[model samples]
Target chain A: MMLLQATGLVAGYGRPVVGPVDIALHRGEVLGLAGPNGAGKSTLLAALAGSVRCFAGSILRAPGVALSWQTQRQPAVAGIPLNGRELLALTGAAPAGLPPWLASRLEERLDRLSGGQLQFLHLWACLQAPAEVILLDEPTNNLDPDGVAALAAAIAQRAAAGAGILLVSHDERFVTATCQRQVLLKGAAES
Target chain B: MNVELLFDPLFLWPCLTGMVFALLLPLCGAYLRLRGEWLAALSYAQMAAAGGLGAMALGWPLALGGPAAAFLAAGVKNVFEEAAESVRGAAYAMLLLAGWGVAVLLAANLPLAERLGHALSDGQLYFTDQGHFFAALGALAVALPALAGLSRPLLLSHFYPDFYRARGRSARRLHLAFDLLVAGVLALATTGIGVMAAFALVFIPPLAAAPWAGSWRRALVLGGGLGVFAHLLAFALALVLDQPYGPVLALLLVALGAGSALLAQGHSRIAK
Candidate 1:
């Protein structure tokens, strides 16, 4: 089934920003979004996440389709003194109790977690959510090679488990390795 | 009828109603405070004032029944305040101040005004020494208990554990329930414009306590205690000075704000 179809999407800041582009995501598809700086990658992702208003377009999706979004910066602070399990539980993504192995492994503070571990936890939170599509904006921006590999592995696992993945990234190698297809948002068109 | 009206159950009813309103407002304030929504409490007080005024103008039927009427009036106030605060402090202040101004203008008919004033606790201006004193006392007695009960919840909701606890919980339901209860209680106690008197109970203590209170409990307790003291003292002062009680309470609140700032400075010095 077509999970999300964005037809004739014309959205941006007031003064002719970006879009007039079309995109579609189907069940179990990994679409990599590649673009340069000021290329409106983040705006596109935001529009898809429903955070940005759609100026002109029809976004059709199946009912009960949840979109999990990950930001470049950790959206929540670790200063609130909640461990991973508690945070996950609070977000309603995980059960109040987890298996011993998973519970023990995820006990690290969000700030204290290694880049790779934080990446894994972020993905884990998304994976555990009831979302059918995962939207990641620069998922591996701060990660090292190993961290990126761990992220790639996690995404692979998620895609295998029947979830659509949409991501915006600059790393060509990472995109080639993970994404089933690529869409490049080129420079703005003439008015 | 004139001599017996003094001892009539109807006469005493307004006093009892005033006392009950005094109690319910702080409960409403505490609930809003716990939600970390001070602006909400202020908004509710303004709303209550407007509704209470309107009810008084309309023959004051609600106030006749006393506490239950006061509660409904308070609920109307809370709801209006909630909507006002959702847009921020400016909207809330404008509504409250504008409403008070309109009420004053509406009470221009001296004879009708006198009757309405008597019906609604003297349009928030209890001029006599005893009337003012009871108001002050009532303000304190009502505020203290509600603060004592709801302090924990209010404080916790702002900090760590409470934040986590509120996660995924439907706090709005709890809020609506409390608002309804307050309104019901207010309805029972208030008559005519006297219902607006609840504003003194709802806001003064928390506002004064915010900057001066060292801990949450201390803030709530001190705020409630001082609110009562300032109110009573202000009312007494108003009677002695031949001033309006509403303006007296308002001025005292302003002074309390200044005094709290000074006290904060002195405390800091003593600690040093």
Candidate 2:
């Protein structure tokens, strides 16, 4: 079943920044959105996530479908003292399938974790959250090779669990490796 | 020292009101500090003070007028949500300045202006009336449970508002609800304890507790405890030394907050 369909979508902060583009996601499919800087990849994701204003288009979701979005920038966790386990709990995500090393450190404060560790942890929270559709932007930015591998595996697992995934990334190799199909966004004028 | 005075209703009511302020303001402060809206508290306090002073001049009940004015100020702030951060800062500063300006102008015209102005700046907690006490208590009643119920979501929203929104929560509404609550609490405190005391209570405790707390929840609890302890200690000192309650309490909180920050730094170095 189609989980989300965006037809003739143009999204941006104020002025039309990205598209008159068409996109759709089906259940259990992993769709990669890739483009160069200023391609409005993030803006497209934001429109789908109902964040950015959709200048022109329609976003249709399957009835009662829920979405989980991981933005390019995670919120600052300093001084919060929340641990990985608590973060998952707050999001209603289970730690059952997380990497062993990551699972073991769930009790540690989020700020105490290295950048890569924290990134994966946050990604896992979004992936494992209860939602029909998951949106991830620049999930590989701070990741190491191992973290990237772990994320790819997790994405596959989530897809296998019947969730539709829309991933936005600039990493060509990773996108080609993990996504079943790719959507390329061009600059606003070009498109 | 007149220990008997401490047992009197005049002294006891203010202390009770201060205790309530100590309990509520720190919780709001913890979230404000986390969201980088610490200045909003001071601005709201000033607006509430201005409202209270205006009420006094018009012979209206301060309990109603102060909250109304603070809520109006909060509404003005809401309109600036999309403005640049610098613009928002300017808006807050302007509200504070306007509040003080209106207060001073009104005080100058009133026969009791000198006394009223002193209370506005320094606070006259000892002169708290039954109406102010009940109003503070009522605010506490509403604020405590509301904060307790919303603490987790509020914390999450502060850090990841978009994430919270994506999860089907209205982050904007949550923010507005929080601001309104803070404004209400400020109105009560400003009318009862004065602007200086209210501002000190809202800003200091969280700062003092920030260094040692491992989590936001712990920081809030610690901050509330610190606020209560400081209020009590300062009250005792004021009674013995016949010093002003507001300045003494504010100074004590500042000293403690600085000490906490230093201690946290020392502890971090030692751990390293």
lDDT of each: 0.56, 0.84
DockQ (0 to 1) for model 1: 0.04
| Candidate 1 off by > 4 Å | A50-58, A70-91, A95-127, A140-154, A170-178, B1-37, B63-87, B100-272
Candidate 1: global Cα-lDDT?
0.56
- In Å, residue B29's CA in model 1 sits off its true spot by 7.1
**Tens-place lDDT digits, model 1, residues A43-76:** 7776776655677776776677777766565543
**Runs off by more than 4 Å, candidate 2:** A189-191, B1-10, B129-131, B167-169
Docking class of 1: incorrect
Global CA lDDT computed for model 2: 0.84
Using TM-score as the measure, which candidate wins? 2
Q: What is the C-alpha lDDT profile of model 2 across A37-151, one tens digit per residue?
A: 9999988888888888887879999999888888877778876656787788766789997887788898888888888899888888788888999999989989988889989
lDDT of 2 at A92: 71
Candidate 1: deviation at residue B229, Å?
Answer: 19
